[model samples]
Target: MAISSAVQGVSTAKRQRFLRSTVVLHAAAAVTGLVMVLYLLAHMYGNYKVFSGQVAFDGYSHYLRTMGEPLLPRTGALWIIRVVLLASVLIHMYAVIALWRRMRKATAGKGGRRYQSRKNPRGVQRTYSSFTMRWGGIIIFLFVIYHILHLTVNAIAPGGASESPYERVVNGFSIWWVVATYVIAMLALGFHLRHGFWSALASLGANTSPARRRLFNQTATVLAVVITVGFLIPPVAILFRGVGS
Candidate 1:
């Protein structure tokens, strides 16, 4: 009997350790995801410069490269930001996988909904944002890779790797297929952000008060819409405005 009790105690301790680690991972992912959201807002702002004219847009791109010039070499600040974002992405993905595994383990024998919120007494149905999160994330991730290749590296430039940032953007959006792809990707991004932003706030302990919770949800919705429209405007404008004339 004593030996059996000891084994049970050890198992409980192991479970506790696992739970603690999962909590830490969840917190880290929430924080990093919020950072990425802020970065996207800044990126969208930069994209809006396209409306000002080719010279303004190109100058904005150039300014990003020389942001911390002299004290830091050209593109130094940009590389630093890239490194930070890359690390955040890796960490965020790791945390997501770990939490997902834990969730699966917990629900192994429970054959009901895999993602229902048990905290709600009414047993409310999941929102579209939550329902589409995983697939939306996949779509956005694939889109980002294609976007970087198409614009950043010129691996698939429409007009043969133009030197002008404005030209590359205009050239890419000139294609109907590219504009269509961008619209789909932006829609996915909007849905992802809608859920992700509010969830991040909850994870960070901002949902304690009813008012705070409502504000967080509203802010998340606004952010999702603003970013989605801001990003879509450039490509849509270029497509309809005639790329060079």
Candidate 2:
């Protein structure tokens, strides 16, 4: 009796610790995701500069590299931003893995088989989002790598990347498949953002009231659409040769 009681006590304590850890991790991931969303919005606006002509667009790129002027070295501010974003990505991934493990353990602990069919609206939304998220994340991740390779490094340029950043963008989008892939990736990003933004707010405890929940949902939807359209415009315009002189 004493041995079993002691074991139970220890297990209970461990469970409590796990719950607290999960909460903290979820909150951290939510905050990091929010930061990334803000960055995406700013990046989308910068991308829109392509419509102003090559000089304006390339000047914007140069400004990013020399942001802080004499107070910071060349690319110093950009590097700082990169490091912060990298840290956020690591933390967010760790939190995701931890929460997933915890959820699996919980399901197994209930003595249920792998397949149980329960149909509820919220549950269905969750199921759909979870299914889409894994693949959507992979797509977005690959797109990011390809985007950096195509534009930033000028390594795989189809029409050649000259000294001008504007030329690289135009050259890349000039390819039919490139624009198609970009559009597809942006669609995936839109889906991911639609679910992720709302969930992040929920994780941060911002949906306590019905009014707040409504506002959060609306904001998330608006943001997702805005970002998707904002990013798609420049690529589509470049592909069609519809923008700039």
Best by TM-score: 1
Provide the lDDT at 176 for model 1: 80
Question: Model 1 shows how many backbone clashes?
Answer: 0
What Cα-based lDDT does every candidate model obtain? 0.86, 0.84
> What RMSD, rounded to one decimal, does every model reach?
5.8, 6.0
* C-alpha RMSD of candidate 1: 5.8
For candidate 1, write residues 41-115 as lDDT tens digits: 889888878777889989999999999989999999999999999998888888877777777788794422633
Off by over 4 Å in 2: 1-20, 109-127
Ten-residue stretch with the least lDDT total in model 1: 109-118
What would the TM-score be for candidate 1 when compared with the true structure? Answer: 0.85
lDDT of 2 at 104: 72
- The sequence of per-residue lDDT tens digits that candidate 2 reaches over residues 1-245 is 99999999999999878756978888987998888898898899899889888999999999999999799999999999989887887887788767767777988844223433455533333535545866888898899889888887777887676878998888878888999999999998988888889989999898999999999989988998999999999888877779632
Q: Candidate 2: worst 10 consecutive residues by lDDT?
A: 109-118
lDDT of candidate model 2 versus the reference: 0.84
